[model samples]
Target chain A: MRLGKRRATPLPELNMTPMIDVVFQLLIFFMLVPHMTRVNKELLELPKLSGTEDQQESAITINITRDGQIIVTNEPRTVAGVVEMVSEEIRRLGGDRSRVKVLVRADHRGTSRMVNQVVSALAKLGVHQIRVGVEVPSR
Target chain B: MRLTSRGVQRDRKIELAMTSMIDMTFLLLIFFMTTGGFMTIERDLDSAIKERPSGRAASSDLEPAIVEITRVGSGYVYRVGSRELTTARELTDLLRKFPNKIDGAYVRVSDGAPFEMAAAAIQSCKDARFLSVAYVPID
Candidate 1:
């Protein structure tokens, strides 16, 4: 009787399907997550209105850039010009000037006086509702 | 078919090429890993606190008293409601004299004002120990 050694069986198993699925899932997550774009550096660091109820969205956002310039709707304007424009907008909106809300967004580096002028202008125009926008200060 | 010796030799070369394909896949992975670092965004302010005021927020009642200061050629003028303040001491005194009314005083500063002048206004508030001080823009 001739003894014949049996040939060893090679395991044929290379499963790549699970690994590819994980890589594709990670790619989808990165693609769908919204990236935080650039923020306006000119806006003031508003204090968080902790415990305050949600305010109406009627407030106008005015930004003040560093170097003491006023920007209304992204347009640079002088103090007087801003007042005039705000006045006209109030009139067109058909609301009581006293009821019109003014939200001032000024950079921290922006001088207090520049902000003061804008607030003074708003007050002169009879805008009674004025809220200072600030980022909530960390404890 | 007879035992194809040449075919077996070619098959060995193809097995070596599989190793080369894996090397290329690793190179691609490293390139992508390095490029993924470009998505970072820097923030100037720290964490934010959400503010939700309930009931009649006393802050809304705080009347904003504004002082405008604009850079003039080389100097600055401190104005209240358009009236220029001649002296810092006078402004400080005015802030001191503000009545302890139900609505706390709101200090609005203009952007055109110098940093020194703005600091003075804030200092005045600090000296008076007014807790409800709100710094806003004048435009």
Candidate 2:
């Protein structure tokens, strides 16, 4: 009779502790991811190319908008300012220009002159590993 | 009086109503998941910009193919040597059919030319099996 009475009572409360812990962890993860991915990326329509290469992690990202405005890390920078920033980055990398990779994200409708200015600046710094950001068409 | 005191002690056991907390957590989780997943993935195209040696004469025997991109009225024009092409397709075909491709190719983009055309020219050179494609910005 005691066993039957125990069974009649509601099921033992689920150990909500572990479930809550996992849920909170997932919430924190999701909260952090968007900021991390969006730090260097600016909203621009990149060129669509068929045989584009994969994206490698770059130390610096330069963005060029349709009006030929240059931005780095969300801050509008001139060609000279960009060079200064790159020089600082190189110093942080132990003065190794070879190890520093730069990614240039230019709007498709933007003038190539702007892209060229940034590329020329990087080349002058002797940083040869440059990547132009593009979007590959989804299959 | 003893039964009442026992009931008060049971109430003090702190039975947290977890259902509301769990519901809120799930709601937050779903919101973050949906927002985070909406970000678009971007890729990169590898490019190299090397500093040109000052006052170096071009060797006629080993000159790379140069594709000049100029902005027209509304569209763009691609010029390879003396040949003028209107579309990237034509340029690609012409580059592919070149008899001597020992040297890679140079994509010279003029001012006001859209980045899309320049990228397409580079992609065309690559598709034509050029060993390297150099981007040169011309004024």
Candidate 3:
């Protein structure tokens, strides 16, 4: 007598429910993670501009570069030279330094620290009313 | 008691490995420890020009010595009384004198000039120890 033949069965379909659940969980986990950042708050402070035309004849304008170069009245000057020249100018202006106003125009790329060096130096001379210049594009 | 060879049998059990779990925990711990703090840069008041209040007008008596900085090709052209300066030192020399001896020193900066040039000018004012600085924005 011949042995009975063994029966073959078809493969069962895969269940994708667990895989979808895992993917959704991972998405939620990543969304909850906080981003890291360092912000500068002091740079946001804006100075007041009196813009009085009457003082126009009394203000001194100073321009700055990213690398800390200075240009004044269409002339180029070194850091020390600028100080010396300003001192002499103050002395010559009837020896009244208080009447001298400084207007500083610096690039956006330059750090506040770089700008402060100029302010501190001016402060030592007992002059006040520092005006900073900003460029607003014409509408 | 001694076991008979025919009656003795070996059994093996499966368990999860803990090395991966330890490594993951260490990674997470290091990540949190190294990146939890943020730095805030303080605003230096001396570097900023104050914002003028609304509805304020310019002084009519002022005669501004307008020093216009025009964008020339890739660089900038500094002009004072129709004069141009080629060196950084020259700019400082002119700024040093400023409105002290002159009636009005108008500082008009171009939008295209390198920031360093502008900063140097401001530094010159600081060196001269002038506190009253005014900045004019160009179109």
Candidate 4:
């Protein structure tokens, strides 16, 4: 066999399998790691209950700051104002009482008296369907 | 001239451009990874427990148990159905004594009771598996 001079070139072949594997790994990690929570009050240090995870929606939301001040969602409300607003909200909800749920989210350092006052006021208005938003990280 | 089969196979290398798609996927994965901790927890409180009428003792036969937590200076005072407990140790002991079944508990909280005391009280009642808890704030 007569041998002829041949050009020896290194093939620029990039391995696509590893790249695809890494991409899918990252995609799955992001998807499974997420916990999409809807309530957006500030970062209140809520107590950690072992595995008590209850998911429910509220008609109105209440936030009790670390210093124990009461705010109905974004607005700071006085006891009288809160009562008036809640009373009106009840009337607005009219037929579907199931929709009228009050969520109380209090800071871990927040006093319960303020929460008590709010609950008492709601009780007076005859709205008992209430949800206490808690912090449930795997303890 | 007709190309041979070997010539045709090596003549063209078809590749789908994946650089931009990989970049976009990486960006999304990073976003979700960083934002995974925004997890919120929701829990429902036992609905509208009828507080005992002011004049009448709670349920003549049952004699509803009450857990009183009052803040005194920087310290806290706890009273469980007429038994006073000044320390957390004592409170734990008292809770351990709770029966397997009970009607409900009335948690009487004072405005001065800080979150620590209030949380402890609520937790104790919950540990006892008390059916319901009514929070009453003393002015």
lDDT top scorer: 2
| Candidate 3 lDDT over residue span A32-121, tens digit each | 453321111122222222222222332455666655556666565665655676687688787687667666655556544345555555
Error of 3 at A41 (Å): 29
Write the residue-wise lDDT of candidate 2 on A5-39 in tens digits. Answer: 22222334556666777777787788778677776
lDDT of 4 by residue, A25-57 (tens): 787676655433323454567654322236565
Collision count for each candidate, in order? 39, 0, 51, 0
Over B1-139, each residue of candidate 4 has an lDDT whose tens digit, in order, gives 3333454446556465677568767877787677655545545444333333232223223255566786556777887655667865576566656564456666677666765565556556666667665656565
lDDT of 4 at B108: 70
TM-scores, all candidates, are 0.40, 0.74, 0.31, 0.68
Model 2: residues with Cα > 4 Å off, grouped in runs: A1-32, A35-37, B1-38, B50-63, B72-74, B99-102
User: Lowest summed lDDT over 10 consecutive residues: which window, candidate 3 chain B?
Assistant: B39-48
* Model 4's DockQ score: 0.25
lDDT at position A132, candidate 3: 57
Query: What lDDT does model 4 reach?
Result: 0.62
Give DockQ per model, in order: 0.12, 0.35, 0.05, 0.25
lDDT of candidate 1 at residue A107, scale 0 to 100: 60
Query: Which candidate number has the best DockQ?
Result: 2
Comparing 2 with 3 on TM-score, the higher-scoring candidate is: 2
Lowest summed lDDT over 10 consecutive residues: which window, candidate 1 chain A?
Answer: A46-55
Name the runs in model 3 displaced over 4 angstroms: A1-59, B1-139
